[model samples]
Target: MFGCIAAGRLVQTNLQQVDVNKYVFELSDPQSINHLVVFLLGTIPFEPGYAATVHLLWPNKDWQLLGGLSNEKPSAIFRIGGGKNNIMMNQPTATLGISIEPIETVQQLLSTLSSGVMKSGGSNLQHAVSMTEVGQMASRVIENLFNYVTSFAVQDLPMNGIALGEVTERGYLPVKAFQTWYNNLSRKLANDPNYLSSEKSA
Candidate 1:
């Protein structure tokens, strides 16, 4: 069972298996999902502290897929009853708690930034990004931006957004997970102005 507490309500979705590289959920409500908790069910094949590459992909302003990676390793033995959400395994398992608010905030901020850049007679976002040396500069800017934003945003969340010490690792890691969730929520909100307006009014 796949479970997440969305909008303070626990929602459980049952699935036998998730394709390794496939996007699992396209959320219908982004704002409602304040916090996300993901559990790795199976035993890992590697030793403790062995890292796994986490991939992330999301469309930019032009809908071009921008990819990123996170080298997340299970560092410590996570105990279930000790407030750690990860299950222990032959190889340690890791849990990632993603707070979606900052992602949305940055998404909105980027749109505003892009507009500001254009209005200031500055070069387009793509043009401002250098294409030299494989060009990770743009990616680095986004990664840093998310972390910068999340630092402040996490302060406002419960327990300071630290469910598990490792779970709270945010910003560009475990890609595709939150990006897919964020986009799904964005699409739903875009399609439902009435609900969006109601939310604002409420």
Candidate 2:
């Protein structure tokens, strides 16, 4: 199953089936999004022998193959925007694509991916699949996990009124198990987006 989270919003359910074996998520607030996390919900796997590929499309920009996820590793995250390294869009919208195809497709895409920045959308998207599992609950959960630190983006912090101890105990940690690791990373970046780079430079 495929799912995505952008700034606390569950977007996988909102994906539009734009073409055969192709699904698109319409991002309403591109700037507010710091990262886009795509994942499989839980136990389901691609019908044996197939995989799902993630791609991004920015108008007037070449289609970029973000990466591909298979049953072996069901989730992958992409820093599409908001990072110092990703595109800073002046426009209000961007599209995220989840492609379904045979296992061989990823190998071919990787060849293009290693060679340079963009791949031909014509050849890459031409392949087709019979189905794709769109992440419903798990997608949102995973997105929220990576996105918790940016919780301050909306308006106010979610656990604002409550005491810190109670908030941490009752509702914070397992947000919204993948939480265990991303929580730490999200907090670190939230405190300093370039913390890792800063460390390496040190």
Candidate 3:
């Protein structure tokens, strides 16, 4: 069924076994979306398209949907907030939470493409073109706002003082020290003849 799913509206129906693994709800009013809450009447995984509608209650009357799990085993409740349409005139900023799969998939796809190119022969013009296409795709995927947040959250935390190990035995340091080391490494990389030549050819 194709129809518009409003940001602040609730939609309920009964289906014996709904497998929403790949199903997605495309919202017509993207900007007006405040929050989406989903309630499942049976045990089910969080489907991609299922969402809940936000209802404004009292005092905190500008009712923002925080996060919650349904009281019943078969039921699931989700709260969505933060979109152009969800903002109130006199409220402090409300954060909209959205969980998106990371761009690791994009990176994995690029890696596969790179492997194919390597197998095909790096000197092949076709392989070069494919590599370029993959790179462009990667850049576009990384630029997506949701992907950016997911990447940041999933990335490994950087170790402290790893850069200053040569100067200090502790192998940990502050931001300024790391910046200096990073700058030096950047300069070296920038001046490397092979790296420059490869970049130019690409």
Provide the global lDDT of candidate 1 against the true structure: 0.29
lDDT of 2 at 37: 75
Candidate 3 C-alpha error for residue 183, in Å: 61
Q: What is the per-residue lDDT of model 3 for residues 97-179, given as tens digits with 9 covering 90 to 100?
A: 22222233222322343353422222111224544454343223223212222222312236542332221223232334323
Writing each residue's lDDT as its tens digit, candidate 1 over 118-153 gives 111122122122221122332332233244334443
Order the candidates by TM-score, highest first — what do you get? 2, 1, 3
The positional error of residue 184 in candidate 2, measured at the CA in angstroms, is 11
What are the runs in model 2 whose C-alpha is more than 4 Å off? 7-12, 83-87, 115-202
- Candidate 2, residue 129: Cα displacement in angstroms equals 29
The C-alpha stretches of model 1 lying farther than 4 A from their native spots are 1-7, 14-20, 42-202
How much is the lDDT of residue 61 in candidate 2?
79
lDDT of each: 0.29, 0.57, 0.31
Point out where model 3 deviates above 4 Å.
Answer: 1-7, 10-20, 41-73, 84-202
Candidate 2 colliding pairs = 2-133, 2-135
Candidate 3 residue 101 Cα shift, in angstroms, is 14
Query: Which should have the higher lDDT, number 2 or number 3?
Result: 2
> In candidate 2, what residue range of length 10 has the lowest lDDT sum?
125-134
